[model samples]
Target: MKSLFKIIIITVIFTSINSCKYYNFTGAKPIDADTFQVNYFQNNADLIEPGIERIFTLELQDIIQNQTSLNLVPQGGDLLYEGEIVDYRITPMTATADQRAAQNRLSITVLVRFSNKNKEEDDFEKRFSHFHDYPANEQMIGARLTAGLDEIYARITQDIFTESVAKW
Candidate 1:
């Protein structure tokens, strides 16, 4: 019985180790290189919100910094991301019998230019967008606005991270 127990334990341990050999402990698998830089994202939308660009820029930096092991630099780094906010608008999503808006959708679109110094082929310029919907009667101020923006920002940042480093 003792010998049988030892054999079982050894097999289980070996199986687990072999299964995880190619798996990255971190959720993200950064490229072979290190160091990354994100330039301040500029708002290029016609109806620009006063501080949207700043908020977005900071959020992206925070997510990337937390997820990856790369160092953030000011100038060129092994990886670079720069972009502009291209669109910010609210559109009526649904209308009631009175022809009034029942729901409004707030959408934001960002264009990103990414470059990998080590691998030019991996570089890409793409657009990422997200939105949130709220009742048209509700004024999009205070907590309402904050919640809407937070939801959009979270999705956008995740998409950006997946494209830039996570390789998802």
Candidate 2:
């Protein structure tokens, strides 16, 4: 009798926990979306950041795959995401008094399109971008610039994922 009572109590607790649902934290009601598709982002710009296309594609994929319970599909997914890297530039933001060198800022912009097949939501077309600054004195500017661009891409991808998956 005692063992049976303990089992019943445990089952009740587990059932209550699983049944509880909230609109916050997870944000929005649990969507029925189960599959997603992401296309390669084209780079049709004069100024190019090497590997920018690959970075954006994979980061966007990673964010959606990790954040939500969405299965990534090659074709005919419940949700579709596609976009392009519209701009990539490295410009001197500031110069030292000597004018020899100073600081540089690297910025990138990506235009994203999101669509849900069954829902009548906005189906947003959004541009997400990020920039990073570094002193000219830093050695191996090429490597640092690459790293900076990667960080920016990560941030931009995160923003996109938060909006599309988290519904925030």
Q: What is the lDDT of residue 153 in candidate 1?
A: 95
Model 2 lowest lDDT segment of ten: 20-29
Instruction: Mark the 10 consecutive residues where model 1 has the least summed lDDT.
Output: 21-30
**Model 2 C-alpha lDDT per residue in residues 1-168, reported as the tens digit of each score:** 999999999999988776544343445445668899999999865797567798789888887777666799999988889989998877787888888568887788889999988784848899998998888777425789678967898899888877776666
Stretches > 4 Å off in candidate 1: 1-26
TM-score versus the correct structure, for each prediction: 0.86, 0.80
- RMSD versus native structure for model 2: 3.8
lDDT of each: 0.89, 0.80
- Score candidate 1 by lDDT: 0.89
**Per-residue C-alpha lDDT of model 1 across residues 10-117, encoded as one tens digit per residue:** 999999888654445556764766888889999999877788899899899888888877888998788999999999998999999999999999999999999999
C-alpha lDDT (0 to 100) for residue 123 of candidate 2: 82
The residue pairs that clash in candidate 1, if any, are: none
